[model samples]
Target: MAVVVGVLAVAGALVAVTGPAVLRWWRPRPASADLIHGPGMWAALRPVLGVAETERRRTWLHLPVTVGEAGARIVLRLPAGWASGEAGTRAVDAIVTGRLPGEWAAHWCRTVAAPYVEWVRNAAPDRPRELPKSVEWMQTGDPLKIHFGETPEGPAFVHTGTATPHIGVSGETGSGKSSILYIPLVAARLAGWLVTVIDPKQNSLTEADEKSGIRIHSETYECVMAIAEFFVSMMAAEKYNGRKYRGHSGPDSPVGRLLVIDELPSFREYVAAWWKYIIRERGFPPVLVWFQLILMQGRSSNHRVLVGTHQFSLDVFGSTMARDQVGTKMVVGEVSIPSWTVAYGAGAPMVDYDETIPGRGVISLKGRRRKKTLADGRIERAEEIQYAYITPQVSDLLDACPPAPAWWDAGAMAPWITPRDLARADSAAAVKDFLPGGRFAGGREDLTPDTDTDVQLTQGSMPRSEAMSDVSGPGAVSGVGEGLAVADLVEKVGAEGIEEQRYTIAQACAVGIIRKKPGAARQYKSAWIKEGKPFPEGEMIRGNASYTREELESVFGTPEEDADSI
Candidate 1:
C-alpha cells in the first residue's frame, strides 16, 4: 500500500508540471475569425487585461467589435479615466496589441466628453470607380446638398447655404482639381444657381465651359470687372434679403450666385498689381473685399465662392478671414505637410504624400450637425474620399441650362472700360500736335504789323497785282504767325465749298486738321498751309488770323486760286 501511495504522489506531481504546457501546445492559435468574435476574443483579451490589472477595471469598460468588408473594428471605452492623456492612450495601445491580432491597427480618439480606443484589422478592398449620375437625377430641392463623390462607405456630400458658403480645393498638378470643379459647377447649375467661372490659365475650365455653357472669364481685366459686377448684385440681394425677397431656393425666390475661381495662384499672379495697390494704400483689393463681403453675408444672400489653388498658403488667399471662413476644405494627392495643415487643420490624417492616386483626398467639412462614424466607431468630421469621375455625358447634362452671361453683361450699374479703350484714347491725343491743323498752327491775331506797308495791305483794297505784291513783300511778315481759324477758312471757302468737301470743325479735329490750344482753351490753328497760294488778305479780319503767302505756299502745295492765276 505504501508503494502504491508513493507512485500515485509521483504521478500527481508530474501531471501538475506538464499538464499546462501540454494544453497550451494542443490549443488552437488565434485565427482572424477567432480574434473577431465568439468566446475566443474574451479568452484572448483576458491575458492582455491582466497586464494592466491594477487599472484594467477603471480603464476598460466594454469591447464592441464589428466586422465589415473593409475590416474589423474593436472599440474599447474608458468610462472612468477617459480624460487621462497620452499616458492612458499608450497604456490602451499596449493592451490592444497584447490582446488583438498582430495585423490590427489601433487609433485612439478623445471624444467631446470621453475617450475611446479603436482597433482596426484587415486591408480595405479596392473601391470601384464611381461615375457621377446625371445632373437631372442628382438635383435636389435642398440648396445645401452638394454631392462630391462616392467612397467605400457611401456617397459624400457638402452643405453650402445652410452650413457653409465656401469650399477650398488644394491639390498638385493632375491631381483631379478639375474634376472637383466640374462636379460642383454641374451641381450648382442643376440647383438653379447662376454660375461664374474665373479661370486664369483658361485651359483648366474651358472644356466644361464649352460642353456645359457655363460662363467663363479668362482675362484678368474681365475677371476683375465680373467680380465687381457680381459684388454689386450681391449687395442688391443683401439689401432685399428680408424685405423685398425671400432668402430660400425656389422658383419664386431670388436666384443664388455661385462663383468658382480656378487656378488661384495664376489668378493671383495676374492680379499682383491690385495686391500691390492694396498694400500701398493699406486697403483690401476690391476683389478680396467683395469676396469677404460675400463670405460674411452670402449665406443669407445666397452667394457662394469656391476657390482652387495648388499653392496652399493663407497669404496666397490675401486675407486670414477669407481663408478661415472656408467651410469645406479638400486636399488631394502629394501635398506638403504644411499644405495638409492649411487644408484640413493640424490634426489632419497622416496621408502618404508620395501616393499618386488622383481624386483621392482628405475632405473636411465644418458646421456639420451630424458626424459620420468611421469603421472604428469614432465620429469623423473629415473623411477619406475618392471624387467621382466626370464623364462626357455628365458634362452634356450641363447643356440643359443656358450659360450664365458674363457678370458685367448682367447689369448697367457701372460703366465698364477696358485697357484697350484707354490706350486708343491716349494714342489719338498724343499725335495731335504733328497733324494738319494742330494747336500750334494758329498764331495770335493781336500782334502788330512790322511795317506801315503791311498796315496799308491790311486796310486798303489795292489792285489784285498790288495785293499779291504786298502779300509777298516783307510788310506781310506778321501774317506768317497769324494763321486763319477753321471758321475763317470755311467762311472764305464759302459754305457751299465747305459742304462740297464734307469738312467741318469736328471732322478737322478727328482727321488731325486742328487741335485745341493751351493759350485760348477752345481755339484752334491750321498746321497745314496751301503751297503757292496767295494769302487770303480778304479773310483777314480783326479777331481772325491769316497766314502769309509764303507761309501758305510752303506746307500745303499750290492753292487752287494761285494755280489758276499761274
Candidate 2:
C-alpha cells in the first residue's frame, strides 16, 4: 500500500506540471475553418460561383485556411473540367457584394500552376497613416527606394534600378506630387548625388531648394542651359570612360546624376525654341533625343530622369519611344480609367477611382520580378502605396551639402541667337571673345552687318578682346576699360593669393568693394586706385559697374604680399 501511494504521488506531480499547457494548447479562441469555410460562407458562395451541387462535390477543392490576428484566407482549387477564370471572377463579384455573413473581400485570384481563388474575410485593416522617421539612401548596385505608401504587408516602397531607369509620376495639382518628388530628391542628396531640378511651376520645389539646398531651375533659359551642360558633361565623361560609363562613386566616375523635370508638359512648351536650335539648326536630335539617350545608356552610367506631369498620355510624352522608355509608372490621386490604362497598360488590377486618397496611388515596375527561391517569382506589378513626408531632420540633412556651382546663371548662352549663329560665331572667334572667362557673358554680341567680320563687340561699345586684355595689363588699376570678368580678376590676383586672404566675391560685394550687375549672367563692377583705401560700410551704388584693379588689391591685398603672409 505504501508503494502504490508513492506511485500515485508521482503521477499527480506530472499532471500538475503539464495540465495548464495542455489545456492552453487545446483551447481554441478561433479557427480559420470556422471563419472562412463555415457553412454560411459556403452557402452564400455556392450559387454566386455557379457551382452545381454535383460539380461542387466532384471538382471544388478546399485547401487549408490561413488564420491571422484580424481575419482568415480561404483558397479553393477548381477541377480540370471547370473554367477557373469565370468562376474566380464571379466569386470575387459576390464577395464584394457582401454575400458572405461577415465582411469579405477578394484579395487576389491568380491562375498559376493550378487554378485557384483566394478570398479574405476581414483579413486585415487599412495600413496606419504614418510617415517615415528618416530617409534612407540606397547603396551602390542597390535598387532605388521611394517610400510611396502603406500596405497590408507594411510600408510600400517603389524601387527602380538600371533595368528600371526612368519613372513616370502623374497626379493632379494638389495630389501630393511634391511629397512623392521630395522623398526621392532627399534620398538622392543623402546618397551624395548631383540632383538637377527643372521646376517650371517654380512653386513645386521651392521648399526643397530653400531648406534642402537643392538646385531648382525656374526659368526656361535656365532649364535649357542646365540640361545642356549636364548632357555635355555626361557625354564627355562617357567618352573618357571609353564610351562605357561605369557607375561608381569615385573622382572620375563621380556620384550619380538625377534630373527631375517637374511638370514636363510646361517644360516642353519652353523647350520648343531650344529644340529648334539644337535639332533643326544644329542637325542634332531634339531634346527628347537626349532624354532617350539617357534612358537607354544612362542606366549603366547612374544617370536617371523622373518626369512628373498632371496627365499620363502618349501625346504628353511626345513619342512612343520616349513614353515606352520609362520603366516605372506611378499614378496618384483620382485618375480616370483611360489615363490609368495608359499609365499601367492592360491587365492592371481594378482600382476604385471613386475612392480617392491624397497620397494613395498605384505603382508598377515593368519587367521586374521579386527574387524568390521556389517556383517562378511573382512579377513586380502595380500596387497601392502611401508616400512619406519630408521631416525637419531630413531637411537639415539636405542643407548640409556643400554649395554647388551657380551653373544655371554661369554657363547660359544668349536665348535670342540660334545654335547655327552661335556655332559660326564660335568658329569666327567671336564667341570666345564675347565670353572671355569660359562662362556666361550676359551682354549681347554686336554683330556687324558684314557677316565675315571676326571681331564681335558688346552693346557697351567695347571690343571683347580689348576689355579682357585691359584687365590683364598694368593700367587695370586706373580702370582703363569696362568692368573685368571675375575669372580675369582671379587670374590677375592669382588664385593662391585670393585663397590666402580667404576672400570671395560675395564678401567683396558685402564690404562695398565690388558691385553686382543685373542680368541673366553674373558680373561684378568696381573702381580701383593705385593705393589701397577703405570704402564706407553702408555705401550702395548701381550703374554700368566697373571694378579697378586697385579695388581688388585693397579688398584682397597684394597677391605677392598675401602669398608671403600665407
Candidate 3:
C-alpha cells in the first residue's frame, strides 16, 4: 500500500506539470492560436542549427553565452549569426519564437552584434486601448508635435518639424484609417497652420474655408497639377532667395504651409491607368517624381505631408526612398499579418498582433531612442497603441481653435497670368521666355483639370543654360525647330506619320520598344539614330528629349504589327 501511494503521488505531480499545455494543445483558442509555440520553427532552423543553440551548446561563433528562464521567456544569449539578412532573420525568429507560451512571439532589437533575442511568455492583455480618458493629460508642448493616439504607456504623438516631418497611415476600409487623421489635421488647423488638402474622395474634409486658412484640391487631374505647381513654386522661391529654402522660420517663412493628401493610392492609380498617354504621347506630368521631391526637401522649408491610404508599400508612395523620409508610419485598427509587414517593413517581428479593437493598432517611428524591452510584450518595431477617438465633442473643441490672422493663398493669381504674376507684353513674348500653353491652376479651387492642355513644366522662367538650350540638328532637336533646314528636308521626304499612342509600351516592347523613365519616350530617337534612320518628330523640351507617340509609331511598326508580334 505504501509503494502504491508513492507511485500515485509521482503520477499526480507529472499531470499537474503538463496538464495545461496538453489541454492548450488539444483545444487552442479560435483554432488559429493552436500553433502559438510553433514547433516547425525549430525544424525550420535545422540547417543553421550547426552553430546556433542546440541541445548541448549555446556558443555562437564558438563564443560562450548565457541562458536564463524567467516567468514566460527563455532569455537566451544565442547565435545572432543566424540573424544576418532576411532569411537568417527568419531562422532566428523561429528560435526566439519557439520559447514563447501563448500566441506571442519574440524579436531582437535592431542590431546585428546585439547578443540577445527578447522573449516573454505572458499572453499580452487583450483589452482595447481607450483614448477619451487620456485626453485631459495630453501635453502637446511642441506645436509641431501632433498627438494622434494613445498607448498604454502614454499619448502617441508625431513631430512634423525639421527633424521628423512626414507621417504615413495605412489600414483597410472601416479600419479607422481616415479617423486617425482627424485629430492631427484638426489640431494643426487650430494651431493656425496654413493647410492644403488633396481630397480624392471629395467627401470628407474636401472643402477648404478661407476663414480657417485652409485650401483644398478635389479632382484627380487638379491634384496632380497642384502638386507640380507647388513643387515648382518651392524651387522658384528657393532660386529667388539665392539661398537654401527654409519654410518654418526666418523672413521668408513658409512655416504656415502644410499639405495633407488623403487616399494617396488614388494618385498612383491615375498614373498606372494613364502612363502611356501621359508620357510618350503628351509629355509626362512628373507626378511621382515631383511628389517625392516635396517629401524629401520639403522638410527644410517646413512643408509637411500627412498622407493616409488603404495599403502601405513602396509602390504606394511611388517608390519611396522617401519612405524613411516619412518618419512616422502606423497600421491602425485590427492589424493584419500583411499590413504589419508592409507598414513596419521587413525584419520587424510581430507578436500579439491580432488587434481587432477599433482605433488601436501598431506604429513604428524613425529617430526614437532605444527603450529597454518590457515584460509587457511590446517590441520596439511593433509598439501597440490606441488612437485618440475624435469624438464629436472633441472635434467641437478642435473646430473652436481659431485661425491665424495672417493668411497665404495659392490661388492669388490667374491661370493666364504671366509667370511672375505680373502683366505680360503679349503671348508671343511670353512664348520666348515661358513654355506656355499648359494647365496652370496656381491652386485655384474653381479650375477643373484640362486634359487638352499639356502640363506646364514650370511656373516661372527657367534660365537657359547652354546645357538647357537645344539646337536643331540630328544630335539636338531632331526635326523640331523654327526656320530650320530639317523642316524642309522632312517636307521633301514626305514623312510617314502615325498617331501617337499606337501601342502601350508593353505592346511596343512586344515588337521591341526599349524605353525607360525620364527617357521612356526619348529612347525612340536614339534607337532611330542607331539604325541610321531619320526620326522627324523628336523634339527637345527644357533640354530633355521629348517624343510624340505618333512619331514613334511611324518609325516603329503600327499597333497591328506590334500586337501581332505579341
Candidate 4:
C-alpha cells in the first residue's frame, strides 16, 4: 500500500508541473477576426507592453476591441495618470499598428480614433486596385462628391460640404503634389464653381489659368485681396458663427468657391510682408485675419479652403483653430513622421511613404459620422493607395466642361467669368485683338490681374483710380522680389501691333484664341506649315500643334463672339 501511495504521489507531482504548460501550448490561437477579442493579442504585444502581470490585465483584461466590415476600433481603460500622453500612446500605437500579429495586422488598417484618446483601424485591401478613368468620377452626378483617387474596391471618393469640409495635400517636392492638387481643381472647374489657385511660386499658374479657368493670385497683396474678397462673399451669406471669411484652405476651397494655396510657406511669407506694410498704414494685421475667419466660419456658408504644400506645421496657419478645422488630410510619398502628424493630427496613421509609386499616399477624411448605429464611421484608408490621375487628360476635361448659358454672362459668378471662359484670364490678349462684335475682356478693367478688389482695402484707404492703376514698379513685388516670367507676348500684343511678336497656334489657344481641341486648329496650322511660310514651329499643348497668340489670332480671328473664350 505504501509503495502504491508513493507511485501515485509521484504521478500527481508530474501532472501538476506539466498540466498548465501543456494547456498553454495547446491553447488554440485566434485564427481570424477572433483576435479582435484581445485574448491572444498579449503575446504579440508583450515586448512593447511588458511581461508584468499588471500588463496582462491592462491589455487582454481591460482592452475592448470591436470589429466590423470597415475596420476595428480598440479602446482602453485608463489608469491613474495614464492618459493619451506619450507613454500611453506609444503602448497603444503598437496595439493598433502593424505591430499586431502579421495575419491580424493584415486584416485591418491602422489609424487613430481620436489621436491618443482612442485608436480605430480600417480593413486592409483584399486585392490590387486598378487605375480608374478620371472622367468617370467627374460624372458621379453630384457636384460635391469628388473622386480623389483609387482604392481596392474602386475609386476612393471624398465628400465636400457640411459633414466633411476642407482638404489638405502634402508631399515632398517630386512626390506628385501638383497632380493631387489638380484632382480637386479639375472637379471644381468641371462643376463650374469658381476655382482660385493662390500660387506663390507662380509656376505654370498662367497656363493653369488659361487651361482650367481658375482665378490666380501669386503676389502677396493680390492673395490678401483675394482672401478679403471671399470674406466679403461670406458676409453676404447669412452668419451663424463668428469667423472671418477669406475662405479656408487656400487650396480651399468651398464647393462653390475654391481657394488653392499651392505653397503654404511662400503664402505665409507673402502674408507677413503684407502684414508689415498694412500694420504701418492700417494699424492692424488685416491679411491672415480674413483667412482665419474663413477657416472657422466659411463652412456654414459653403466656403471651404484646400491647401497644398511641401511642408506642414501648425505654424503654417495663423491659428491652431484653422489647422484643427482641416477635415480632409492626405500625405503622398515619403515624408517625415512629424509632418504626417501636423497633416493628419496627433497619433495619425503610421503609414509607409513609398516615393517610387506615383501619387502613393494615405488619406483620412474627418467627421466620420456613423451611417447606422453599429456601423464603423471611419471613412478613409488604413493603408496607402495611388490617389492621383494622369496629367494628359486635363485639357480634354477642360474643353468638355462646356460653356455656361449665354444669358448667364451678366449674372456670371461674382467675377463675371463663364464656364467656357473658365480657364482664361479676363484680360485675355485675344479679346483685345478682336474687332467690334462682343465686349471683349468684359469688366477686365475693374479687376486687374494683379489685384482682385479695390487696392484701397490693401493700404488702409486710397483713391479708387489709384487703386485701379498699375502698381507694378517698386514695393509691389512679393516674396521672390524679382520677375521670373519673361514678358509674355500675349500681354504685349493688341496695342499698335505690340512689338511685332510671333506665336504658335497652341500658344494662341492657351491665350484663349482657339478651341483647346485638336480638330480644326491642327488642320489649319498644318495647311499653313505645309506651305513652308517660316511659321516659327510651335509647341504641342495637348498632343496637337499650337501657334503664338498673334499667329492664332491671325488664323482664327477671335471666332466673333467666341474671341474671349478659350
Candidate 5:
C-alpha cells in the first residue's frame, strides 16, 4: 500500500508540475528577440515558405507581436536558407515600415544568395474569388488547407479556391451570422452561381437586402414551396427546353439565385418532401449550399454543402451522399465534433477536443493528390486540413439593410403606421377631453400646468392629464449612471405595464444602440439639468469604474445619438 501510494504521489506531482510546464511551453509565445520578418510579413509568406519539420506548406509559428512605443517586432529562430540576400534586407525594411504588403514584397524579393528563394514565393492556385463579404480571404496555408484532409499536404496551399474551403467561424449569439453569411452570398452571386442557404436559428436571414438577388424565407411549408419554385427555375434555366443540364440561355439563364431559409428543423418533416419536389416535381441541380445545421442530417450526392455548426455530428460521414456530395465541411467553433472521415473511409485526423482553444477547429480534408518526397522521404498521409482565421470585416452595407419588421407591428397586432400616421393621428389631449376629470379615481392627479413644458412640448401636446398611479412605499430608483435604470427608464417612458420594454432595451444593446455596462451598475443623468458643467454624458457610476472620453466615443459614440441609435 505504501509503494502504491508512493507511485500515486509521484504521478500526481508530475501532473501538477510537468503538465503546466508542458502547457506553458506549448502556449503561444510573445515576440522576443527579432525575427528577420515581422508577424504580418511572416503570415503573408507562411503559405509560400513551408515549415521545416512539417511535410506540408502551412507554417505554424507561435510569434505574437506586441505593438508598443517602439513599433511592432517579431522574434523567430529562422531556418536555413532564410534571412539571405536582398529579400532579407527587404524583410528588415518591412519590419521598420510596419506595413503588410510592403513586408510581403520585401520577403519575396529576388535573392541570389539563396537557391531556394524561388520556393519562398510559391503561390497556391487561386480559389474562386467569390466568398462571403464578411469572410476576408486571407492567404492560404497547407495547415489551413490540409487541416480538412480535402487537399494533400504541400508547400502549394495558397490561392487554392473556395472550390473547396473549410472555414471556422466563432461568435456568440446575436454576434452577426447574417454578416458572416453575406460574404459567400456575394461571392456566389458574383460568380453567376446559385447559393442555397439553410439557417435553422432564423435570426440571421431576416432583413437581408433583396436587391442582392437572394431568396430569403422562413422554414415553413410555404417557404418549402418557394424553394421548390426556385428549383424549377434552376431546372428551366439549365434544361433549355429539355436539351441538357448546365446549358442555359435567354433571360432565364442560371446566373445568380440563392435560396436562404432560416430555422431548418422547424420544417424537418418536410425535407424529404422538398427533395422529391425538387427532383421529381421541379428538377434542379445544386450549385452551392450553406447549412447552418438542421438539414445536415440528410445529404444529396450532387450538390456541395457548407455545413456550419457549434458541434458537428460524426453521423455526417456515415452517409455516402455527404461523403460524395459535400466537398467542403466547415466546423465553426472549438466544440467537440464526431469524426466524419472514419465513416467515410477518409483518413481525416481527429481534432483536439480542447473546448478552451477559443476559436480553433480541425477540418478533415479529402480529394487532393499527395506528394511522394515530403516527410522523411515518405509520402505524408492524406486527411490533411489547415487552420485559418475567419476574421469578420465590418461593412456598412450590412447596416444599410433594414431591421426585420417585428411581430408587434404585424397586421394582426396593429394596423401599419407610416410617418403619415404621426401627422394624422389625434393628440392624446384630444382623447383625454372626453374622460371625466382626465384622471382615474384612486390614482394621484397633480394639476401641474402645461406651461412647464420643454421647447418640444406645447399646451396641446400633454399626452393626457397625468394618469399617475398612487405612490406606494419608498420607491427608489436603483443604481446610478448617465442613463435611467432599466426599470426606471421603462416607468419614465410610461411603459411600466408593457412587457416589451425590457426586450426593446436588450435588442438595442444587441445591435450596438445602447451600451450595457457589465460587472458594475450604472444610472441615468440628463444633460438638461446640469447645463454643461463637466457633463459626463452617460456616466457609469460604479465605484472605481471609469472610462476616458476617447474610449466612450469609440464604444458608444457621442451620447446625443445613443437613444436614437438604440
Candidate 6:
C-alpha cells in the first residue's frame, strides 16, 4: 500500500505540469492574450476536459481576456450563415436545463451559440463604397465605409453623408471606439474638408497633431467656445455671402463640408458652452460627433452626430434628441441591463452576445437581430504617424499671395492696417503686379482691363516657362526692373475675394504652404509649384505700363532682369 501511494503521488505531479500535452488533441494549443504572452497549463486542460473532442475554442482572445464562461458547452461544425440564421433560432431553442444556473445559461448562449450569428453576418455580401475615402484613425490604410439599412425608424442610408444624422455604437472599454474616429477624419482630409476636433479627453486628437488636413484643439471652455463660434460664424457667413460652389470658386473660397468631435460627453460636461454653440450654430456643412456617451437636445439642419457609449439605458438617454435623432443604435456585448430594451425602440426583443469573441461588437439593425461580430476582426486602434519635416518646395507655392487677416500677427503687421479689418493691398500698382490675368484693374477677381494691359505683360505667354515664372517671380524675367514691391502686389491681388478667402490665404502662409521673403514688407519671392522648379508660370517683367521691353535696359530703364534678382 505504501509503494502504491508513492507511485500515485509521482503520477499526479506529472499530470499537473504535462497534462496539457496529453490533452492537446482535445484542447487548442498555445493561446495568447495581448497583456500576457502565453496561457497556463491548467487553463488549457480545464477546457479540454470540460469540452468533448468535437468542441473547439470558439473565439480568439486578445485583450480583456478572461477565464471560460460558466456551464457553456462548446459544439463543433454548427450549420452557419444566412441559411443558419432561421435554422439557428429553431435548432438552439432549448430551455435552460435545471442543472445549470440562469446566469450560467445566459453566458453559455453568448459563448457557444453566438458564433452562428456571427457567421450569418460574415456570409452577407459586401456593400459598395459610399464615400470617396473612408476616414481611418488607425495607421492601417483602411477607410470607414458609411453604410445604411432599412428599418421602421426610417431608412438607414437617409443620413449617409450629412451630420444632421446621428448613430450610436456602444461597447465595453477597448472595444474599438477610438479606432473608429480615424476613418471619417481620413475621408475628410482626402476630400479637402477641414475638421474641428473637440477632445476633452487629451488622447482623442493625439493622432491628428502633425497630420496635413485637419485642425485639432484641446482646452477647457475658452478655446472650445472660440472654435464653436468660428464654425458658427463661417456657416452664417457662407449663407450671408450666398457663396455657392457655382462650379467655380476661383481657387480661393471657403468650402467646408465636415466637422468631427471625439469624446463628446466629457466635452459637453466640461465645455458645455462650446457644445451648445456648436449645435445651435450648425452652419458648418455636417458634423461627425463621437463620444463614450451623448445626451444632446438641440438639432440643426446642417449637422449630424455619431455617439458611442458603453451604457445602453433610457435614463442616460436623457433628451428627446436621443430617441428622435438616433437613427441607428448599435449595442455591443450580452444583454446585461434591462434598460437597453427601451433604447432599442418599441417592442424590440433583447438578444445575447458572446463576450469571449474578439472584435465582436453588437450592432442593432432595425429589426434587432442577435448581437454579433464584424466580418473583419474588432477594429484595431492604430498608432499615430509622425511628420517631422516640411520641405522647401511646399514653402514657395504659398509665397505668391497674401495670407488671411486672422493669421497675420497684428504686432508684426502693425505698420500695415487695422487688426480688425486687415486689407491685402497697401499700394495701387501692387495690384497690377500680382493678380493673374492682370496688369488690368480690379485685381484677379475682375474682368476689367487697364491702359497698362498694352505693356508686354510681366508674365510671358509660354505655358511651362510662364507658369514657372508665375511661381518663381519677376527676378528671372528678362528686362525686369528692380524695386517692384512683389509683397504689396500679392496683397493687393489677394483682396478681391470674400473674407474667408483672405483668411485662408493668411492661414496657408502661416502654416507654411507658401514662403515669404524676410526683411522685406510683404515681398513675393517664389511659389512652390514643384520641387526644384519654382514659379514655372511666369516672371515679373518690370516694364512700366508704357514701355514694352525691347532690348531690356532700354525699355525698362533697369540694367538686366538678373541684375534685379532679390
Error of 4 at 558 (Å): 16
lDDT digits (tens) for residues 48-117 of candidate 5: 4445434322233323343332323333333546545567545544443453221212133244442232
Candidate lDDT values, in order: 0.52, 0.51, 0.51, 0.52, 0.32, 0.33
- TM-scores of all models? 0.49, 0.51, 0.49, 0.51, 0.32, 0.34
Query: Model 4, which residues run further than 4 Å from truth?
Result: 1-138, 152-154, 204-207, 211-213, 239-255, 275-284, 367-382, 402-445, 448-566
TM-score of 1: 0.49
Tens digit of lDDT per residue, candidate 2, span 1-566?
99999999998998887776675755555565445545565566566566776554224534234443345555665443455466656665564335344555554434466666666666454654443333333223233765655543465655666475677789888887766776667667766666778886756765565332245666443454455544543444444345354343333443467888899887886566444542223443245555556666666656677889887687777666667667777877778778776776545554543225456666764434452121222233666555455634456657665543343223233222345544543453223432313222212221101111111222232444544454343222212212243335455455554533322333333233433212211221112211234532322222122344464555545556645776
Error of 5 at 356 (Å): 3.6
Top model number, TM-score: 4
- Scored by lDDT, model 6 comes in at 0.33
Worst 10 residues of 2 by lDDT: 446-455
For every candidate in turn, the CA RMSD to the true structure comes to 20.3, 13.5, 20.5, 14.6, 27.6, 21.1
Worst 10 residues of 4 by lDDT: 434-443
Q: What is the per-residue lDDT of model 4 for residues 36-148, given as tens digits with 9 covering 90 to 100?
A: 54655555544443345556544433333335444454554334333344674565555655444323332222244422234445556466554442323344656577787
Residue 507 lDDT in candidate 2: 32
**Ten contiguous residues minimizing lDDT sum, candidate 6:** 380-389
Better of 4 and 5 by lDDT: 4
lDDT of 6 by residue, 1-566 (tens): 99999999999998987797676745764443322422332234324234343533343322223223332342323332323354444333231121122232222223445342211101233442232111212222221234222222222222333232455555556655554444444444444444445555655545554233334444442223323333332333233244363334443444333345555455455544433442222321111121211213222313334455555454334444454455555543343555354445334444443444432333444223334333332111111111111122222312322332332111121111222222222131122122223321111221111111211223222243333443344232111111133333446545865332221222122222223221111122211222343322222233221111222222122433435564
Q: Write the per-residue lDDT of candidate 3 for residues 108-213, one digit (tens) a residue.
A: 6655565666555555556765434333325374658777766655666777774557888887777877777666677666666656677766555522322345
Question: Model 5: residues >4 Å from true position, as ranges?
Answer: 1-183, 192-196, 205-211, 240-248, 258-305, 309-319, 335-347, 353-358, 367-566
